[model samples]
Target: MVGTAARALIVSERRITGLSQVVIADLVAELGPVWQARRDAELCDRPRRRAVGAGAKYKLVFVDRLLATLVHLRHGITHDVLACWFGVDRSTITRAIGEIRPLLAGRGCRIAPGLRLRTLADVIAHLGATGQTGIIDATEIRVRRPAAHRRGRNRFVSGKSRTNAMKALVVTDDRGRLLFCGEVRAGSVADITQARDAGLVDLLADTVHLEILADAGYQGLAAQTYGQVVTPPRKRRGKNLEQVQWLMAHHEQARFEHSSRRIPVEHGIAHLKNWRALARHHGHRHHLPDTIRAVAGLLSDQQATHKRKLAALPTGQSR
Candidate 1:
């Protein structure tokens, strides 16, 4: 976690020191077509570029601006607050977020089984680290008007909260390589429901063999799907000690150890929020979950890179 001092440093640097303007301008440049479309669509500015649009009608904005703006909204900052953060007009943000949505969605990179295999080689590294396959769990993403919030009506949930929200399913190997990211759906949906609906079973059947460790929420989903998993057993009435212990080993020993290591994955979730800068936990915020998942995947990538570098290091210093 970034300390209060670090956060203050950041806020002061951007807001008080007048870095907001330079950064926002840089972001508008970095995000390319995504920001450009937003700029033109919003009539943000008419900066001249030499045939930069190709056939497109907009000039580009930086990814950093778009990301920073997302962070502002996540923190529950108002449009005016965001304008203050960026040293721009409040309407610019509404328009930028409006245009940025489709840009991120439309750029969706489909992960074929083969790509999963290639990108997630580190799951095996995790298994080697611990004696378990991997862990699985589902989390809900709270939304405000999720129905009208995201582009797809299918992804929103109106029943889960006082407002709306979405549920996300994630699986990571023991070491934290995200194996799968199911479609974002409304929070009203059950974790298991989204797993099936999201096609996790199909993906596992075709491309994976490691056991999945999950919480009680995924009860029976393992057997129903792949006949594998190590989840904590539920304590029900009429069960004796032997029965309880017997129930425990459904990947019991491994899952316990798995949880010891796996619980840190929640930190990844926390890390995402740090980056997102959200205000309330639940909002009509649609794309934040996907961005968080993407960042998690990038974590695995980074770990893989770091590991390779370490492997190549001199033997004694390797860690």
Candidate 2:
């Protein structure tokens, strides 16, 4: 257990870290022995320098490193602040981030396996069995502009936000649990273009019951793909939608209904953005994809934890 002052400096349990203290403690309980073994092996890799008191003990323990990394991801706090918070050197903070990020990313990537809807048969089997579906959409993460002389500076400037950013696709179950994320691309890339390049369209082509919910930016995706795709109906400029299109209450109302089901993807994206690092990354832009994937994995783990708790509750109990 951490001291009160240390707990105050670290993230609050009320905040999202992809894992609560209960979950994180459970994880530590399972991984602590393995991590100590790995640390021993690493130490064995180098012979000890016999000079007395040459190397001092690390300020933060292994569990602290893990906690600190999650805090950084949760709030995008600076390394200097983290060092001060953990009573460690700035380099130690950086090293901890580098080490723990991949583990988190791996956890995020594992969420994809629950989506067994790879083929049309699989999709049919899934919906027929569970009566549920998935949604797909693109979200952008802000990044520093590329160097002036860089080849693709124009490609990274987003038309939507009119700022430099990276684009990624997020897929979620209807309940807003993230299924997949991270086909990270330049901001200027069109949604349909990225969807096709990411093989999202191709994958959906083989699925029948799992619909891909997107905005009209993916207008042509439906024509080129076989799986169900839903989007708001297009409206023409200089003409009111009711007058120029379908009847007064029909078309516009249908779009509203579709949006009701489609709104969950936005919530999923918002959940990811809760990790402010994804909102504005200050590090190497190349690592953005891994960061996004890492966060997605944390979101999945958090969702699973919630589900397990809810399941453990007595039936008919208010959530």
The candidate scoring highest on TM-score is: 2
Model 1 Cα displacement at 175 (Å)?
Answer: 2.2
For 125-165, candidate 2 gives per-residue lDDT tens digits of 45435656767789999998888897757989899999999
Q: By lDDT, who's the top model here?
A: 2
TM-score of each: 0.57, 0.81
Steric clash pairs (candidate 2): 108-297, 120-206
Give Cα distance to truth, residue 172, candidate 2, Å.
0.8
What is the TM-score of candidate 1?
Answer: 0.57
**Deviation in Å, model 1, residue 63 alpha carbon:** 6.3
lDDT of 1 at 163: 49
Show the lowest summed lDDT stretch of 10 residues, model 2: 116-125
Residues 23-136 of candidate 1: C-alpha lDDT, one tens digit per residue:
334334545765556556644355555444445431213443455444544344566665665555667676666555444333222222223322223333344345566676
Model 1: residue 23 alpha-carbon error in angstroms: 14
Could you tell me which 10 consecutive residues in candidate 1 have the lowest summed lDDT? 108-117
